[model samples]
Target: MGKKFFVAGTDTEIGKTTIACGLLEKANQLRLRTLALKPVAAGAERTAEGARNDDALALMQSASIELSYEQVNPVLFAPPIAPHIAAQQAGKRLTVSQLAGYCRGTLMTPSDFALVEGAGGWRVPLSGRETLAGLAVELQLPVILVIGMKLGCLNHALLTAEAIRRDGLPLVGWVANRVDPDMSCFDENVETLKQFLPAPCLGVVPHLPGASPAALAEHLDISPLGY
Candidate 1:
């Protein structure tokens, strides 16, 4: 049983994959085998391998070990929409037990670090009743929240933290990703989050003109994560 962390974003497109890949880059430096899983994804494009998700692909590329796309993302929907809606459109049901079981199996693989990225926000529904948060609790993995720094981010970040605590999940750390380039007082916003969030802010990723996990890893400190 190796170490694992559940990565959840304040909202979708909040750079969760970016932070996860950065962590993987750091883990690689230590020569630790890494595995990343995007349990459910909505947007996908057809390729020779089948429906492909950019986020999952990035994780696969960053991982120290190679895993087929299915292992990286077990549940994928072609349409770019809310995961629950996409599942409904495809006549597929998303359940907490099934997703949690998949993650447990993946963690059992021979790897030093494993990251399981959730589909959407913490409370996003999988089926009509089960939420992603519920799956996190079932797995009992420590969580890392990705905060997309933008207008109203304070509310979103704080609320998500409170919910994670309420569900009894340890918030191991957080990443502050600059999603909005023009957002004013970025430092002040980050300070406010640092002052309020229960866990330490592991990294503050700026809008990268180019995407390089190794470059982004320079800004992150995962030492507190005990990995």
Candidate 2:
């Protein structure tokens, strides 16, 4: 068994899936067996058999371990809304324990590493009072904060790190994802983060279309994130 990490973003649309895949790709390149778990994914597309999220699909692509879709994405909702609301519409109850059980069963087996990706932001509701932060706390895995480089991102990143710290989870490192091409002072923002954030900037992903994980890994300079 190896270190399991919870990959969280400052906000939705902040490239959590991209960063998770990049980690898997990089670890696999080192010839380590890896698996990815999405835990809970809302806004799924319906297929002939069932529904799936693109993030889930990408995780499946990156995972060296073959897991059933249910193992990778346990709680899935058809609509793209808050997990609580989506679950309500479908008459399903969402809870951290349900997700935790799935992860336990799936990841209990030995492997080089496991990366569990959370949906939405850290404080997004999983159920009534169970936020993603609570789940991360329960799992007790080191966290990889994915900072989407954009206007107002500094506040988002700091606030999220504070929340994670308050939750008492380990802040392993972070990735600077350039989601905004026109984000002014991007390098300056990175410099500030390097100074303030206790964790290293694992990577700074430049804005590019069709950027492979191999290319992303080249720019990544963070010390190996975990044991």
Identify the candidate with maximal TM-score: 1
Each prediction's whole-model lDDT (CA): 0.89, 0.86
Error of 2 at 92 (Å): 1.4
Off by over 4 Å in 2: none
Estimated TM-score for each candidate: 0.97, 0.96
User: Which lDDT tens digits does candidate 1 get at residues 50-80?
Assistant: 8899999999999998987888898999998
RMSD of 2: 1.4
Per model, how many backbone clashes are there?
0, 0
In the range 141-211, model 2's lDDT, one tens digit per residue, is 88999999999999999999999998898788999999999999999999999898888778889986567
Clashing pairs for model 2 are none
The numbered model that scores best in lDDT is 1
